[model samples]
Every structure is written in structure tokens, then in C-alpha cells.
Target: MSLFRKPQPITVIALRDAPDLVTSLRRALETATDAERPGLERALALTEDVAERPDAELRGRWVRRHLDAAGYEGPADSVNAIRVLRQAEPGLTLLQALTYARETAAAENTPL
Candidate 1:
């Protein structure tokens, strides 16, 4: 049996308070060969664009919007975020922060 199973769909949510962190995470995910890479890339681009906007509230709302679009519906707390990711993708073997974000987004049906 292969430990590396198919990647599940995921959603990624970031608060406006952490746009830079999210951008860096997206850059890292862009180099990933995992199935969630494409979505992450898309989310990254969206996040980047949102980050560039002038309004902070709008930026946060954009993050939430993307998360919703991606299918996540949890709060942006670190603990729940990790739980959401783990629950969504059992094959998700890595413990990296990006992986958590990706998995969390993919598993939930609402934005966090």
C-alpha cells in the first residue's frame, strides 16, 4: 500500500492580520507537487491581490470569501484550523503549516 495517497480537495483561510504570512505560505505551496497545489496557488494569487487592496476590512473579508469559495467554514483559530485539515485529508502526512491550511480549506464547507 502506498502511503502517498491521492490528495483531497482543500480550502485555505487567512485573516487580514496575516496576509504576508499567507503569501509566504502560498509561495511555498507553489513548489509543492501535491494535488492541492493548484488550489493553493489560486488562493495565493487571490490573497496577494486582496492584500494589495487599500481597505483592511476588505482584505480580511476577501480572505474569508476565498475560504468560503474553497469550502471551509471554521473560525481562523490555529487549533481548529489544524483540526479541520487533519479531518479532511487522512493521507495528508505532512505537519507543515501550509499543509494544515490547505487541508482545512479542502475539508470544510464554510470559511474559517
Candidate 2:
């Protein structure tokens, strides 16, 4: 048997479905221990915030917020990096894309 499991495909759900997503996260949070609380709470908050804003560019805003939280201060650079990452790897989760983008940005001595 293989030691590692296959990477699951990440689903791209519509922003309109945020309520269901929030509910599911809340349920998970209810049973999550202290260690898992922060990440779950952050996800819940981000989901609700995104749902409240009727932005046509929802995914861009999400990527921007994630980059901001990670201390990537260049707004335009952040947007461009995420755009390239999405185009290059459409299947990447936000975390995966941002992580890779950040590493690349750092290695290139550029902002992201």
C-alpha cells in the first residue's frame, strides 16, 4: 500500500453557497479541540465576510485577503501573483496557491 494518500480535488463552490459552508464549518468547530479552533474560526469569518460583500471578483478578493493576512503588503503585486498562480494551477486550493506564490515571490525578491 502507498504511504501517502492522493491529493483530493478541491471544489470551487459559488459564493451564494456560503451559508451552507458556514454552517458546516460551525458544526466542525463545535467538536474541534482547541488546536483546531483558530484555523476553523478564521475560515468561518472569511466565509461570512465574503458572503456579505457582493463582489463580482470574489476569488480575487479572497486571494488578496489571504495575502494580506500573510503579511504580503504589495496590493498590485499580490493580485498579479495570485492571478498567475490560478492560471497555472487552477486546481490549487487557496492555501496551496498562496503558499507556493509566497515562496516564489520571496525567492524572486519580489512582493506578493
Query: What is the C-alpha local distance difference test score of each model?
Result: 0.54, 0.64
Local lDDT at 25 for model 2? 95
Give candidate 1's TM-score: 0.30
Query: How does model 2 score by TM-score?
Result: 0.37
Badly placed stretches (over 4 Å) of model 1 are: 1-15, 56-112
Residue by residue across 1-112, what tens digits does model 2's lDDT show? 4547675554433358888899999999999999999999999999989668543245445555555665556642475666655665578755556655554454446344
Error (Å) of candidate 2 at residue 4 is 61
Q: Enumerate clash totals for all models, in the order shown.
A: 11, 0
Clashing pairs in 2: none
Q: What is the lDDT of residue 31 in candidate 1?
A: 81
Clashes of 2: 0
Candidate 1 total steric clashes: 11
